[model samples]
Target: MVMDEKGMVMNANSDNLPKDCPQISETVNLIVHAGQKYATKFNGKMFAFDQQQWNVKPCAKINITFINDDQIRHQFMIHGLPGYLYPDGMVHLELYGEGELKASLIVPSQKKTYLVHCELAQHAEKGMKAQLKVGGGDGDLPNISAISSPIKMDAYSIDWTMLKWGGMVILVVVTLIFVSGRWLLFRHFSRRK
Candidate 1:
C-alpha cells in the first residue's frame, strides 16, 4: 500500500501476471470520475462513478486514473482478483478527498465480472458502485445503479387512503374553475352580440 496526503494505491500490479495468464493480452487506460454530479441522472442516488460498467479482455492490464470530485473521501476498489497477483484478491485506490490517483492491475484469463465500488460507509449503497467485466463477464451484479435490477428495489408507494379525499377536493376545485371561466366567456360573448 502506497499512501500519502493525496490518496492511496494498494495491491496494484502492472507487470505481475496471474497463474492462469501467459502474458498480458492488452493494456487499458481508464479514467473514472466519482462525484455527486455523476449521479444526477439516477434517481435517489447521491454519488456514483462516471460509468456503471466497464468491459475488458481477459488477462488485460488496466491502468486506472481515479478522480474524486467530491470534497469527501472516496475509493475505487476492485474485488475478486487473483490472490497471487493482488493481496486478498483485491486492488484498492482511494482519495482522501477531492484528488486523483493512478493505479494498475492485471486481471486473470477468465470470463467473470468483478465488483468495483467505494468501501466507505454507505457509499456503495448510495450509488458509488460499478462493475468491471472481464471477457464479457459471467453475468451482471445486482444494484449496480442503472445497470441491473436491485436486489431490493426502492418503492415509492403512496397511501391512497390518505390522499383520496385531497385528490377529490383538488379535482372539484379545478372543475369549478374551468366551468366558471367558460360561463363568464359565454356571458361576455352574448352581451357583445
Candidate 2:
C-alpha cells in the first residue's frame, strides 16, 4: 500500500502470484477513468467507471492506471479474489479528487467474474460498479452500470388514490378562490355606483 498527499493505494500486488497460478500468463494494461461523464450513457447514474467490464486470461497480471476526473474521491476496487493474496479478497486503489494512481494485480487461473466498485457511500449504487472477468469469467455481475440489470428494479409507482384526492383538493381550492374573487369584485363595483 502507498499513500501520499496525492492518493492512496491498497492491496496492490505486482509480483506475488495466487497459489493456484504457477506463473503470469500475460500482462494487461488498463486505463480507467472515473467521473460523472462516464455515466452519461447510463440512465439514472451519478458516477461510473469509463468502462463497465474488462477481460483477461487466467493468471494474467493487470497493470491499471486509475484516473478520477471528478473533483471528489473515487475508487477502483476489485473484489472476490483469493484471500491469501488480496486481503478480504479485494484490490483497492483510490484517488481523493481529480487525480490518478497506478497499481497491479494478478488474477488466479479460475474462470470467474470479480466485482469492481467504489466502496464509498452510495458510490457503487450510484454507478461506480464494474466487473473483471478472468478467462472470460463464469457470468456477469448484477447491477453493473451499463453492463447488466439489477437484481430488483426500483419502482416509482404513482398512487392513483393519492392523485385522486389531490385533484379533488385542488378543485375545491380553485372553486373557493373564484367565488371569493367574484364576490369581492361585485362588492367593489356596487360601492362605486
Candidate 3:
C-alpha cells in the first residue's frame, strides 16, 4: 500500500482507484528490457515477454530507458496513434549499437489504446507487441497469438523521384493557372481601355 500525495490510501496492485486521488506530476521512469532470445519463432519476432507491457495515465510525461541485454539490435516502437498529436504517428527508439537508449514523451489527454512493439522485421507479429493504456486502456491488447502474421517483404522502400516529381507537377500546375488567370484579366482590361 502506498500513500499518494493527497494522503489517500492506494492499493498499489489495485487498478480501481479514484481518478482525482492526486496529480502524478512527477516523472515516471520505465525500463524496457530487451534481448534477442525474446524473439519469437513466428518469423523471428522480438520482445516475446508479456511483462514488457507498460501502461500509464494520459497527461503523464514518461522517461523510458531501454537496456539491451542481447547481442543483436532491438527497437521500441508505438503505433495506432493520432499523428497530429504524435509526429510520424509513432515513437521509435532503436538500440542497434548497444548500450542504453533513453527518450521522453508526453501522452495526449485523450483516453485511448496504443500499440507498442519492435518494428524490426516480424517482431510485432511474433510477440514483440504490448498494449499501452493511456488514461486507462481498452482492456488487454491483442495477444501475440492473436496478431496476424506480417507479410514477408520490404515495405519501407519509397520512390523519392516519384514523390518529388509529383510535388513539382502540382506546384507548376497551380502557378500556371494563377499566371494565366492574371494575364487574361490584364488583357481584357487593356482591350476595354
Candidate 4:
C-alpha cells in the first residue's frame, strides 16, 4: 500500500501470480475515471466509473490508472480475489479528491466476474459499480449500470380507481365551465335586446 497527501493504493499486486496460473497471460492497462460527469450518461445515477465492464484473459495482469475527476473521496476496489495474495481478497485504490492513482492486480484462472465498486455509503447503490470479468466471466452481476437488471426493481403501478375518479372530476369541471359560459352569453344578449 502506498499513501501520500493526495491518495492511496491498497493491496495492489503487480508481480504475484495465482497458484493455478504458471505465468501472466497478458497485461491490461485500464484508465478508469470517476466523477459526476461520468454519471451523466446514466440517468438517476450520482456517481460512476468511466466504463461499466471489462473483460480479460485468465491470469491477466491488470494495471489500472484510477482518476478521480470530482473533488471528493472516491475509490476503485475489486473484490473476490485470492486472500493469500490479496489480504481480504480485495485491491483498493482511493483518491481524496481530484487526482489519480496507479495500481495493479492479477486475476485467477477461474472464469469469474469480480465486483468493482466504491465502499462509500450508497456509492455503489447510487451507481459507482462495475464488473471485471476474467475469461468473459461466469455471468453478469445484477445492477451493473446499463449492463444488467437490478436485483430489486422499482414498481410503479397505476390505480384505476383513482384514475376513474380524476377523469370524472375533470369532465364535470369542464362541462360546468362550458355551460356557465354559454349561459352568461345568452343572458348578455337577452339583456341587450
Candidate 5:
C-alpha cells in the first residue's frame, strides 16, 4: 500500500503473477475519469466513471490511471481477484479530491467478472460502479450504470392523487384570473369611451 497527499494505492502488482497465471497475456492502459459529469447518462445517478465495463484477457496486466474530477474523495477498487496475489482479492486506488493516481494489477487466468467501484459511502450506489471482465467474465454484475439492471430497482412512483387534484386546482385558478383581467379591461375601455 502506498499513500500520500495526492492519493492511495493498495495491492498494485506490476511483475507478480497469480499462481494460475504462468505469464501475463496482455497489458491494458485504462484511463478512468470519475465525476458527476459522467453520471449524466444514467437516470437518478449522481456519480459515475466514464466507462462502465472493461474487458481483458485472463492474466492480463492492467495499468490504470484513475482520475477524480470532483472535489470529494473517490476510490477505484476491484474486488474478487485471486487472494494469494492480492490481499483480500482487491486493488484499490483512491484520491482525496480532484487528482489522479496510477496503479496496476494482474488478473488470474479465470473467466470471471470482477466488481470495480468507489468505496466511499453511497459512492458506488450513486453510480460509481463498473465491471472488469477477464476472458469475457462469468457474468455481468448487478446495477452497473448502463451495463446492467439492478437487483432491486429504485421506485419513482408519482402521487397520482395529488397531481390529479392539484392540476385541476391550478387550471381553475388560471382560468379565473384570465376572465377577471378581461372583465376589468372591458369595463375600463367602456368608461374611457
Candidate 6:
C-alpha cells in the first residue's frame, strides 16, 4: 500500500483490481512528433502532415507531449467525447511554432472509439486524421495507408477554373441583356419624339 499525493491509500493488491485489468503502474506517456510532411500520398492525393494516430488504454491517465518540427504552426486535437471528461468536450493542444507542448487527459473507463484530427480546413479529410480506441472497444483503427482520403485540390484547380468560367459566361449574358434592353428603350423614346 502506498499513500498518494491526496493522502489516499492506494492498494496495489491484485484483488483490488478487476480480474482482467492490466496493472496500473503509473501515468502513461504518449509522445507525438509533428512535422511538415507525410510518408506517402493516397490515390494521388497529397497527404496533410498535421495529425497522426495514437493508441491508448481506457481509464489510463495520459500525458501527451507534442513535438513540433515544422517552421509554422500545428495542433493536436481529439474530438467526440463526453463533456464531463473534458472542460470543453475536447482535448486540444496547439503548438504555435516549432517547439514542444505538453497536456494531460484522463480517458474514461468506457469502451468507445474517438476521432483524432486537426481542425484545419480539409486537413482532416486530406490526411491529418487519426482514431483513438479506449478499453479495446473496436477491433482496430484502419491502417493509415488503407484508409481512403479525399483529394484536397487548391482553389485554383481545374474544377474551380470551370466554375469561374461558368460565372463569367453568366455575367456576360446578363450584361448583354441589360445593354439591349436600354438600347430598345432609347429607340422607343426617340421614335415617339
Candidate lDDT (C-alpha), each: 0.93, 0.93, 0.61, 0.94, 0.93, 0.59
Say which prediction, candidate 2 or candidate 3, comes out ahead on lDDT: 2
TM-score of 6: 0.55
TM value for model 5: 0.79
Tens-place lDDT per residue, model 6, 49-159, is 434445567666667776767665566676655564454557776665677766666666667677776576765555656676777556444434344333454555578
Indicate the residue-level lDDT of 55 in model 3: 70
Where model 4 places Cα greater than 4 Å from the true spot, the runs are 155-193
lDDT of 5 by residue, 1-193 (tens): 9999989999999999888888999999999999999999989899999999999999999999999999999999999987888999899999999999999998899999999999899999999999999999999899987778888746676778899999999999999999999999999999998
Off by over 4 Å in 3: 1-26, 37-46, 145-193
Clashing pairs in 4: none
The residue-by-residue lDDT of candidate 3 on 26-74, one tens digit each, is 3578887766565544354545533445678766666777666766666
Q: Could you tell me the C-alpha RMSD of candidate 5 in Å?
A: 9.1
Two-way TM-score contest, 1 vs 2, winner:
2
RMSD of 1: 9.2
Backbone-clash count (model 4): 0
Name the lDDT of candidate 6: 0.59
TM-scores, one per candidate:
0.79, 0.80, 0.54, 0.80, 0.79, 0.55
Lowest lDDT 10-mer window, candidate 3? 8-17
Pick out the ten consecutive residues of candidate 4 with the lowest summed lDDT.
151-160
Model 1 residue 140 CA deviation in Å: 0.4
lDDT of 2 by residue, 24-143 (tens): 999999999999999989888999999999999999999999999999999999999999999999998989999989999999999999999999999999999999999999999999
Better of 5 and 6 by TM-score: 5
